[model samples]
Target: MRNRHAKDITCTILLAALAVSAATAATAQDGMGDDDGLAATDLDLSGTDLSAIDLSGTDLGGATRLKPIVVEARKFEEPIREVPFSVDALPAEEIEAARIRNTADLVGRVPNFNFADTGLSFANTLNIRGIGSSSALISPSVNYYVDGVPLPARVFDQRFMDVRSIEVLKGPQGTLFGLNSQAGAVVVATQDAVPEFGGEIGVEVGSHGERKLDASVGGAISDRVSARLSGTLYGFDGDIRNIVFDGAGNVVRDDKSVREQYSGAISAKVAAELSDGTDAVLSLRHSRSRERPTTGVWLDDPHFPRNAFAPVPETTTETTGGSLEITHDLGFATLTSLTGISHYELDLEADLLDGFIGGAQTGLPPFAFGAAGANVRRIDETSSQVSQELRLNGEIGDRGQWVAGVSGLYSDLESTTDITSLAMANGAYTGRLKKTNLAAFGEVTVPVGERLRIIGGARYTYERQQFGGTYAGRPGGAPGLAAFAESQESTFGFVTGRAGLSFDLGPELTVYGTIARGEKPGGYLFFNQFASIGIPLTEFKSSGTWSYEAGLKGSPLADWLEMSTAVFLNDTSDEQLFTFNPVAGRFDVQNADTRSYGWELTMTARPTESWHFGAAASLLHAEITSGNALIKGNDVPYAPGFTTSLFAEYRHPLEIARRAGSAFGRAEYQHVGSRQIDPANSRRLDAYNLVNLRAGWESDSFDVYGFVENVFDEGYTTSAYRAGNAAGGGGVFAGIPGSGRALGLGARVRF
Candidate 1:
């Protein structure tokens, strides 16, 4: 722990020195906000046409004060104060200032948002309000979207290079979005075509052979048309040290895979004014990643990647999608039509006892699996989806607003897995699934008076799904059955809704309460390892959750400090968990009832023009209320007890090449409490703390910055599961190690 103490001391000294330098500066130069005035009251909206105002730049950070912000989160543009819920909107400025490279960075910035980084970007999972599944294949409580199209898990981990805005809505958002959002939703809007010719180019290089090049170009093509094109290419060699050990349990050597992974993505879009009252936009995107996958490590020895033997598997993933949206004005109302399609593919070739499962398996010694080279695991997966929706939005003179929509979706998934490991009895599995869904949803807000409002919404959905798969059995050392193929289909119908009340104590404060129901349809999982035996294919039932929340928001300390607080309780039934089967493969699935209660706080302060602070905290308690009697009271898997983030930044003027520029130093602290990794409570991931530091200088046209993440090099694990390397290592566990200390430099230019 001495090294940890030293890191803390070093961080303290550096930050103290920077703060001192800022305070003792001879002069301070005005920044972008100097003339504009950073205060909310100082905003000047005079002479601007509210009807044509942009909603993409809305700042909904604190519900502390009610401002006339037009936000487009409910599939319709509306005043932020009237939403009567929790929503955090971060535009391009905040994205750039925070140096948020990917969706994972959003965890600390928002209360109750959690991300589990499983080393494989494509396999990460997002959770909100202490609710998440142990595996990625299950129906997610929280969903992700880009523009208006839902993103499959295979591409949800893509980098955010040309993002324009991101909006996070907490709690059940089933009525507000088109996707399967049982818990919450994250919506991302990439940079769109601008009326003027403009773009940016950026380059970044960091440790572990990290290199990135991203660029974007956009301009008006005609009086009524504009187009934009953006792309990003990045590569990272492996950082985890793979150690080879002898029978004596001693590390003998290290394996390094340098310059072995790369990824690239491109997005293109065009916007047009078809007529005086009509507009349309079309967008397309493609992304691909080819990498030597990071096999996991032992949780107790995260820094020492023992038995992460290779020839490493080469995992390749690709995603392509397109979307079109059209809007028309009908005098008293507006009509919108949207259609989208997406395709995803994954190809993985791995080893059973070595490169596939990290560290240990079945609690057996790592050296026992030295000859696992003969055991191979190969998988190929493909998925595609098509969605269409039509909605109408309107207002009632001086009363309130309303929106209604109808949407339909169709999707297909296919996968094949072959495992030659002796532990699995030399088996293979293949599966195919198809789903079709249709739904109608509506929401309305009615003003009860100048200080009070009532909001209500509901949705009715019909779903049908079909699944089929086969297991190739081997009759050998383990019991086996004849190879059999089976197919099953299921149908479901459900209704969900939300109701709320909001009272405006004044222009600066509001109190609100809401109760909503969220749900996920039940379906068949084609590849259950247990089903390979005499067990029949079992279809899980649908799940539902009722969330009740009450909160207060406002600027209690006047214009400089803004804060919000909320308390919530959730009751759920049939929550699904997909995980590794202790005896064989990774497709084990189950369900349980759960209860969770939590309180959250978010604050932002600008005590002075040169200093800024932001903080958020989420304290929660979640437990299984029922289902399996053995662990009925166990804490919900992967649901941390608490999470928090604190941030501070100081800005000062600097003389660069005889020109005035801004220099800034920023510090951030984030923490996640410990939690169980499985419903059975056989394994757990300990709490972890991280410190990140950043410093930079920038002008209006360009910026240069450097950052050090995980400055303390704290050892942690992002995920833990049953290990496959051990013979009978059921009690022992292995995990995907979290990132270590890494520093990097970056530069960007805008024209």
Candidate 2:
């Protein structure tokens, strides 16, 4: 059945691709023949011939063309085409059109990006170019930032509100972003307070009982002060079902993976003119979010593949953060200071039914199973961090530009877990981890000639970690075994750097190449408590990557068309690998060597005044070059060999009660290739395709829209894990299924 579904999705994707290609061809043909219609209508139509105007005195260069996209991923403002790296910038209009609310929505939209769902929001993992961590104890390879403020991975599940842009920087960013960005970085810039009074309110309703309400308001409070406030409320009834029941056969549970969420944020800014040819601006922002998490289901269960037999699961998470940014402009340089703090907490309870199945087969009685022949696990965690940064930027006689900065971070984390079952009396574990980090970094770019430039950067980082934890367990009401308390401290220091060159062949074309180094510090695993029983925990070492890349970007056909392509190779030593140790019933991290290489191409075009199209494709190859025998030469888990996305939107003027309005329609399709789920390559998920369609009508103040996602209702799995690794005891397979077909309607009002 799964094979059939996969084949059907493949066929649908091919058909959609062909249709979009045909539409683009038709649009281009029409544009070629209708030159008069394409001409500016405001020009004189009073028998004015083309040769009659004097064009010699007019400067019709790039000044009238579309402006280039500016990005901050490099710690300074620069045009994307001149950065010498791969970067995807999704603007506010695109975010709103796609209804993107979280990082999970960025899968195929960004090349070489994927997310692994573990049923819990906080436990979700992000993979970029096959570099990521599956264990909760490890930090993510891809770093995330909001308005220049770094964020912890656990809090990445927050909602997007009043966002202005999202920039995804591919490849290692350690030279500027520090340790956690070995793979890449995601920068989210929210909307700031505007000088004019304006706001928008929106509401949406969708399938599976989904509902959402969002609003934003901003305006000048005084001559020198401005403020903005935004909020969102969203919820959805689950899609999965539970089939387990007692002898009476009454239904016990329904709607297994529901989500309820709410989030809000506010920002204020003050500006003043100062002496010494200087200006000052101060900005403050705060945000909070809460959500009820979702869970997965059994994949090979005898009753139903998408149904669960376990007791209902529950998860709750809360997060809050604030930041302050102050900038001062000097005559020849700019100085900036940033301070940020964040807090996160989570509580979770789940039924380990898969483990109970193995126990029941062993003739375990009801009393021996704890409650209704089942086992349970409960967990609680809290984390907090504070960070500060200071930087200075300046330019030198139009030939060179430089930026230097210093940063510091302090963080604390605590976690506790309890396991209960009739077969085992009780077991518990507690851990506390603290971390401190400091860094100084700088980058300089110099113009070699009129069309050539050289760029170099370096960072020296120091990190310290302290871990303390205890574990205790008891069996059959006997004295507990494998009980101990231990504390350990470690310090690490490293220097990472980057060098690159870029050349402009012409006003419309640029080519560049770069070589860079990235690093991740080593840390202790608090979950490895079985060492008391002589089963030593695996050792982990700091990991580092050397990346080489080349890219070309241009507007080959004019300002209406753009194209970019890049190829990169990464060699990693002491790469951290996370896997389950079934014998010890724990997760461990090991060190290995790996390699990853990929190429990506993106194209965008505006064929006519009302038509726009975009397409992106990526091809990747990742493997464990040297590792444990079980995984050596195997493909990296969750690293799809190929991925692609295509989108098109068209808008036309509409006459509604003679008001100036427009109607627009958009279609998007994404495809992901097959991938392995574990180091042993024991399980693989087939490739799948998704189709989304949207249409809307808008006036100056009011707008209405509707969308359909997963138009074909194709069944597919987003992530999977071995039962032994997830539920403790031996079983077949468990997985998280992707969402089914859904339709939604929405409206917005602007003032």
Candidate 3:
């Protein structure tokens, strides 16, 4: 009887695991799924573009477990449900429907991600799972990539123009993505060239005199070849104005607004079939974008003249990138190779303070020597990367499936910056920075019993960095100036890996546990002006983290609802950090041990054929564990307390003048909790919630929609930057306000 009871319990657990797996598969397949092993009838694969194909069947219970395109979880391209981690997949359709503009707009709407500071001109900084490096000058705690290519540091925070799907990989991912991806990685997939004739054009008009237009065309040039190209144009007048004046004082409100952004891409693909039931495809992509900004917004008074702010002198960014990938399928597994190259240039000219005049404004010390000129920066950056991945899969014992793969990555980057007091003027200082990295990685998976699978993976990485810069000082070396030129180069390497187990119960349930180690390489602070002080700065130090996670994913009651929950803990040693001090008027690089643990829950349900509801929430706890004397037990900067998003969409069938598409309406609510402004945990930001509503009608030929964001126009700050008052009269930091509520209308046509 005892043995029988144990067998029954084991079987029950296995069934539960299977159910979770199914839900996970379903979720991964379509970004939505239920608990049952059935699909949804409302999901018409043929009625929509195949690119929108989320799952094979409408019965979403099995959708989340399928392997997705463009990404590999564990060792295979299988669905995210099998990866044993929380993944928020944003499909191209959803992104288009939501009209997301930049990376910061993705926060709150995506799981485990948030952005605290978003002021026009103030770089959009992002935090993932309660961990982010607040300083934009340093490499981000989370890595950002476009079409499998990393964006260089100087261009990392630049706005995104043309994009398709955006995938946020939460938690440490050093094994696959490498040292800079200790916290997580974001992947942006551009729209690929379609094989069939298709095209789309869209235009949007909204408040603040905002205007945007996007267009794309794709078709097959020959039976065996295809191509696609897309472009976007956007412009907006500044909503806030600078009421302050120059020495002339003639009510000079700086028109610091922006009026330009452009992006375009083209791709071609060739396919060939082999005798051994194999296929090969070679493709290439090229894209570029540029933008000009007057200056970020700032106000001398927050009460009456709220609209007062001005664009400084001049600011601009230009980016160009391209990639080529070749893939061959040998019946059993696929071998793929990718090569990418990119270049970027940025130029800026700005009045240091918009609220305070440059002259002797408010008794503040000037950054310039003797004369106060417009602060200007000109930067040029370039990078190249090549990666190759080979995957092999085979059936094991006729009851299990197995997969293994090896990957190699090589990257090189070089950037140079020129600083001056005015646009179109001679540069005052010049600095150069460079980094190179190489990595080799492999992973394997094997099924144990009928219901269990074990997986293991490891990666070895080598990284190097070089920094050189020159700073000139006035005669006699001013009190705050240092008379020295500096340069440094360092190299380091490390290994990281992961091991995990997955158990499958019923067809609709699954349970998984995983432990992984990830690392990030540290480098010299060449531009870190404060390093010259006696801060004991190190040339190079590697930061590493270990993550522990356990989770259950499955459908609970009916086929219409599915849910996933996970608990995770992350421990780190010598974590990289950038700290800002208001009193010292300085920014410092430091290291500390830290611990982070959190719980996440995700749910998706289709109560009715036309109605869909989804929600994801995460509660996080992060604290300093040891190693830092200045900040021993303080919370990590830029980490939000909690983040959540809830969305409901309804589609209604209509004649629509005899057209076949449907009309849909969606309402979404996103919430970000209050957080500490600095590591010391002194000032606190108020929690805020936003409501967005959209209504639209779409068919194979056309789409029309309208939306309202931040419907209530609530006042909030997305981020803060410290402007140390060494003279000690004004406030230490300035908070940039989030954008106000705006409404817009849009239209899309396809041919």
Among these predictions, the greatest lDDT belongs to 1
Model 3 — TM-score against the truth? 0.82
**Candidate 3 local lDDT, 438-553, one digit each (tens):** 77776666778777888777888887777766544432222323434567788888998878888875555678898988887887654545322323234636778888889876
Off by over 4 Å in 1: 3-70, 243-253, 258-260, 301-303, 355-368, 371-373, 473-479, 579-587, 724-730
Query: lDDT tens digits, residues 512-604, model 2?
Result: 999999998988765644533434344378989999999888764444456788899999888777766455566577677889999998876
Model 3, residue 169: what's the lDDT? Answer: 77
lDDT of 1 at 282: 98
All candidates: TM-score: 0.89, 0.88, 0.82
Model 2 weakest 10-residue run by lDDT: 47-56
Better of 2 and 3 by lDDT: 2
- Give the root-mean-square deviation of each candidate in angstroms: 5.3, 6.2, 9.3
In candidate 3 the C-alpha lDDT for residue 400 amounts to 45
lDDT, residue 220, candidate 1: 96
If candidate 1 were superposed on the true structure by all CA atoms, what would the RMSD be?
Answer: 5.3
